[model samples]
Target: MEGHPPGLETVTLPPYSPELQPVERAWNLTDEPLANRCFESLAEL
Candidate 1:
């Protein structure tokens, strides 16, 4: 197998960094629809 060398990398972030994550924003936006609504089937959800 041939591939580029691998090494550990360090990631840094500031406190309260979830605001920068898109998935977090999406989850927050979907909270109301997911909570107050009921789905009859998996497809409906």
Candidate 2:
């Protein structure tokens, strides 16, 4: 199992609109590659 190191603290940031998230936009723009390519095995995926 993994153990956390000493002196760890969580830092919170101000909430931002989802529209500002680049990842979300990228996901929305990109089509599902898995669906387009048929992979029968886990290795292929």
- Top TM-score hit: 1
Q: Which stretches of candidate 1 lie over 4 Å from their true place?
A: 1-16
**1-45: candidate 2 lDDT, tens digit per residue:** 236577776555459756655577776456566456777899877
Q: How big is the positional error of residue 3 in model 1, measured in Å on the Cα after superposition? A: 14
Query: lDDT of all the models against the reference?
Result: 0.75, 0.64
- Estimate the lDDT of model 1: 0.75
TM-score (C-alpha) between model 2 and the true structure: 0.30
**Range of the 10 consecutive residues with the lowest summed lDDT in candidate 1:** 1-10
Best by lDDT: 1
Q: What is the TM-score of each candidate against the true structure?
A: 0.45, 0.30
The all-Cα superposition gives candidate 1 an RMSD in Å to the true structure of 5.4
In model 2, pairs of residues that clash are none
